[model samples]
Target: MLAAIAAVAALIVIGLIIGFVRGRKKQGLPQEPPPPPPEALREDRPKITVDAEPEPTQPLQLEDLVPRPPEAPAAEARVTPPPAPPADLGAFRSGLKSTRGNLISRLAGVFRPGRELDTSILDEVEEVLITADVGVHTAGRILEALRTQMNGGQLSSVDDAWGAIREEARNILASGGQGLAIDQTPTVILVVGVNGVGKTTTIGKLASRFDRQGKTLLLGAGDTFRAAAVTQLEVWGRRVGCEVVKGKDRADPGSVIFDAIEKAKDDGIDIVIADTAGRLHTKVPLMDELKKLGRTVEKALGRPADHVLLVLDATTGQNAIQQAQLFKDALPLSGIVLTKLDGTAKGGVILGIVDQHKVPIEFIGVGEKVEDLKPFSADAFLEALFESPDALDPSEEAATAS
Candidate 1:
C-alpha cells in the first residue's frame, strides 16, 4: 500500500511542470531570443569604435579632384642652372701665331725707337704685307690708310700702326658678313673646290657642326671621280652619326648630289651637305661640270642651293685668290671656307679674298680638330692677328716664346 502512494506523488509533480511550460508558450516568450537587427547580423557592416576625439569631415570639392601643380618656389629650387663661362680667345691667338710671326714680327724692326714713322716705314709695312701674301690691292689700301694716320699724327709707334691695321681688317671682314645662312629647313650646301683643298674634310667638319646643334644631317658623296673622296666622306658620315648618299665609283656627281637632296626631302633631314669632285678651277670644262652640279642641286631642291661654299687652302697664298675668282665666276658663290690657316703664313690671303670679292669667309680651319673649323669672327681674327703677344694672354706669350 506504501509503494502505491509514492508512485501517485511522482505523477502529480510531473503533471504540474508540463502545465507551467504550456502557460509560458501561450504568453509568447522567445524560444531563443529573436535574431538581432539586420545591421547587427551583417558581418560586413562598418563598426564604429568610440574615440576620445573624432576628425572633422569636409564636403568633397572639384579642386581636390584635379591634379595640383607643383608650387613655383619648390619647382625652381629643384633645378640647378649651369654656370656661364667667359669666351676664351687663346685658341685664336695660338692658331694665328704663324701668320702673326710672318706679318707682325717683320714690323718689329720697321717701327723701332730709332726709326721715324714716315712714308718710308709705311712703304716697308706694305712690302711686308705683300710679301706675307696679302694681295697687292689690299696691301695698297692698308698702306694708304697708314699714310693718312701718320699724316694726322694718329700713329706714333708700332702699337698705333697695329690698331689702325686691326681696324681696317675688321672693317673689311665685316663687309663680307660673318655667319652662314641656314634659315631654311633642309638647307642644302654645295661644297666645291679645286683638287686637294680639303673639300671633303670641310664637309665632314660642317656635318659635325650641324650634328652637334641637334639637327639631322645627310651627306652626298658627289666626288665620285675619286673613290677615295667618296670613301673619306663615308667615314665622316659614320663618325658624325649621319647618312651618306653615294653613287658608283665613277657615277656622275650631279646625279649623286641630286639624289642626296631628294633623299633629304624624303627623310626630312635638317641639313644636306653635298661634296663635288675636286676639279681644277682653271679648267673650263671642270668648272662647267661644277656649274652643272649646282644646277642639279637647284633642280632637286626646287630652288637655288642655300649655300655654295668654296673651300680654299690658305697655304696656296695668292693663288687661292685666282681659284676664288674662277669659282665665283662659275658659281653663285655664297661663302668661302679657308682651310690650313694654322699651317700657313699666308693667312693674310683672307683680307684679300674678302676685300676683292666681298665674299664672306664663313669658316676657317685653324687646326685639324672639328672644333678648329670655327665660324669666321672678325674681332677674334683681328685680335689674334694684331694683339701684342704679351698683352692679351700669358698663353699667347708662352706660345710666342716657344
Candidate 2:
C-alpha cells in the first residue's frame, strides 16, 4: 500500500510541474495591450493646422466690374430777335416837303437879315401869303395883324417878324377841338365830296383809325352813282375788319344808308361812316339830290346826321374854298378833310378854308400810306411848317438876307 501511494504522489508532482511551465509560456509571450476606447484612437489620427496672419489681396480694375451705358451728345446754343418802322414825325416831315419848300421857303425870304421893320416887309409877306393860296382876304387880315404888331413896336428883328407871323397864324388857326364830335352812340358821319377828292380812301383810312381805337365800325356804300364805289368800299371794309352795307349800281344811296343805320342799331356798332355820291357843288340838281339824301337820313333814323365831313383836294387851292362854300349852303359841313396835302404846295389853302367858311379842319392826308392821314393839330402843323430847319433851302438863306 505504501509503495502504491508514493507512486501516485510522484505522478501528481510531474503533472503540476508541466502545467506551471505551460502557464509561464502563455504569460511570457509578447501580447497586444487591450484596445483603447474609440475616442483615444481618433485623437491619435493626423490633424491640419492654419496660419493666424494672411497676405493682402490685389485691387479690382474697372474692366473687371460691369460697364456703364455711354451718355448722349450735347446740343448747341443760339438766340434770335424782330423789326421796326419809321417814326410818325419823320413821316410827317417827309410829307410836308412840297408845301414847306414852296410856301414857307418863300415866306422866309420876306424876313431879310438886315431889312428894317417897315411896310415893304409887310408887302412882301402879303405877296408870299397870297401866292401860297391863303386867299386875298385872309392874306390881308394877316398883313393887317402884322402891321399892327410892327406899329406897336413888337417887331424889331427878322426873328421878331417871324414870331409875329407865327403868332398871327396860330391865332387864326385857333379853333374848337379838331377831333370829330361823336357825342351820340352810333355816330353817323356823312362824307361828302366832289369827284376825285379821295372820299373812299379817306373813309378807308378813317375806318382803320377807328378800328385801332377799338371802336366797332360799319361802312355804308351810299355812293350809288358809281358801280365801282360799292366794291371799293367793300374792299376797305374787309381790310379794316368792319362790316359794310352796300347797294346795287345806281341804287338809292339813301336806302343803303338807312340799311346801315338799322344794321348798326341791331349789331351795336359804335359808328356808321356813310359814303355819298361825289357831286359838283355848282350843280343845282346834284345839290338838290344831296338835300334829299340828308332828309332821307333824318327820316330813316329819326335824327339828323352826327357829322358832315367834306373832303377837298388841297391842290385845288382857292377852288376848294369855293367848293366848301357851296357845300355849306347845300349841307351843313362840320369839318373839312384836306386830301393831297403832300402833293400840293397850296397847303396854305387850309387857312383860307377855315377863315372863309369857319369850318374846322379835322384831318389832312400827308401821303398815300395808310398811316399818313393824321388828325389835324394846329400846333403840330405850324411847328412842322415853321420849326423845321431843313424847311429853308440854302439858296433861300441868301434870298432871306438879301
**Model 1, residue pairs in steric clash:** none
Query: After superposition on all CA atoms, what RMSD does each candidate show versus the true structure?
Result: 18.9, 32.5
Candidate 2: the clashing residue pairs are: none
lDDT per residue for candidate 1 within 61-155, as digits (tens), equals: 44457676654453223222222122226666677777777776666557654565567777788888898888999999888888888889888
TM-score of 1: 0.74
| TM-score of each candidate structure, all chains considered together | 0.74, 0.74
Per-model CA lDDT versus the true structure: 0.79, 0.78
Off by over 4 Å in 2: 1-88, 388-402
Poorest 10 consecutive residues by lDDT, candidate 1: 78-87
Question: Number of the top candidate by lDDT?
Answer: 1
